[model samples]
Target: MDYQVNYINPEIKLSNYTGKLFKTEAAFTDHLLVWLISGETKIIQADESFVFGPGSTFLIPRNQLATIINIPKDGLPHKAVAMHLSAERLRAFYNQESIKQKNTVSKIFSFHKHPLLESCLASLIPYFEMQENFPENIASLKITEAITILSAIDKDIGSILANFDEPYKIDLISFMEKNFMFNMSLEKFGYLTGRSLTTFKRDFHKAFSITPQRWLTKKRLELAYYQLTEKNKKPVEVYYETGFENLSHFSFAFKKQFGFSPTTLQKIKTNS
Candidate 1:
């Protein structure tokens, strides 16, 4: 896949992709507002998966791990406008407005074809080509406008936008078991679990009685084996989803752990 990004500013961008499906694992520091203009996108979180098509608008809160797949639809390229609502910007807006905080445990919020939001995001497309001349003040206003629209739509949005709290130390074992499918660095995993790198390693060892890397690899391979054998999934389909970066590495690790390649397991299952 050929991917391109046109920046309206540091925080706002137009993303375009032409070709086959592209997948990426990401954990954003700021909330993301995406307005899909064409094609389709699937976002997989630890607990759930969401799919969005053209004219879909969705919000991904900060400090979350997700695997995103972008696919071109029909003959057109996958295209979307994305805006980042930075904590700095949110602080200013919330402080000025004194928005009341509401507690929420929601993961992702989706709005389909909302006229006001669609218009707000659509108005920014022209600015992508004139990024050099785009005024910072206008960009700020656009962000503020988006936040206002979101607040109007969902009164409790302050729980996500107005409040900015770093991840607090949580149950490492439970977090790891639920989220190990994502391909993120150990440091990132530590941060999300509210630990420093050293603390993460120490706590992980205490909990699992094994190093984090070894534990993660073993768990991912085990899941891959089950998917290949019981789910009848192909190696190519299983590798990325099971947290390996590539098929070669997944095959090598699977063989090392199970004494057979993933494809070999599939062949055996098929022959039986």
Candidate 2:
């Protein structure tokens, strides 16, 4: 399979991939607007999962953790156009507007076949070819159009887009339990949990009586073991989803922790 990403600028891109499925854990720093042109995408969050087929458009709020899977379906590659709605731009846009902010929870907002959003995103397609000469103001205008459309469609969007506060202190245990499957640095985890690195380590020790790295590895490997032995899932499928970066690393860690390889456990479970 071939993979390509064309950037009209740092904020806008067109992605095309053929053959194999691609998966990754992402922590979005800016709000993302994605318009799928072909194939399928499944976004798995802490509490919910969403699947978007061809022609689906959605917005993912910033400072959120998710596992994204892109699959090539029906002989077509997984192709999509993504626009990043940066915080800097949003703050500037809302400053001159008289929009009221409301408190809202972070979640993926799907705009299914919305004509306005489709038109807005589709207009950017040609700009991918004009990469070198793409006008900055034109991109800004499109983003403004998108923000306007979103505000008009959803009344509560003002809060999500305009409220730029960092994550407040959250329950570390609860947050970690729900989001342990995502592979992120300790620093990122600390920031998202609303604590400094030192505070995070101190709090984590008080809560779990173990180092963060040790706790995370133990939890991930236990989950992987359960998935292999009880769920009968493939090692390939379990590794990345359980927060490990690669299969070899996952296998090594799994063996060291459990005294047997994931594949060995799977075979034993199957034969028994």
Task: State, as a TM-score between 0 and 1, how close model 2 is to the true structure.
Answer: 0.94
**Tens digit per residue, CA lDDT, model 1, 1-272:** 39999887899999999978888888999999999999999998878889999999999998888988899998999999999999999988888777666668858999899999999999998888773667899999999999989989987788778777899999998899999999999999999999999999999999999999999999999889888888888998888788888889999999999898888888889999
Identify the runs in model 1 with alpha carbons over 4 angstroms from their true place. none
Candidate 1 worst ten-residue window by lDDT: 97-106
Using alpha carbons, what is the TM-score of model 1?
0.95
Q: lDDT per model, in order?
A: 0.90, 0.90
Clash count of each predicted structure = 0, 0
User: What C-alpha root-mean-square deviation, in Å, does candidate 1 show against the real structure?
Assistant: 1.5
TM-score list, all predictions: 0.95, 0.94
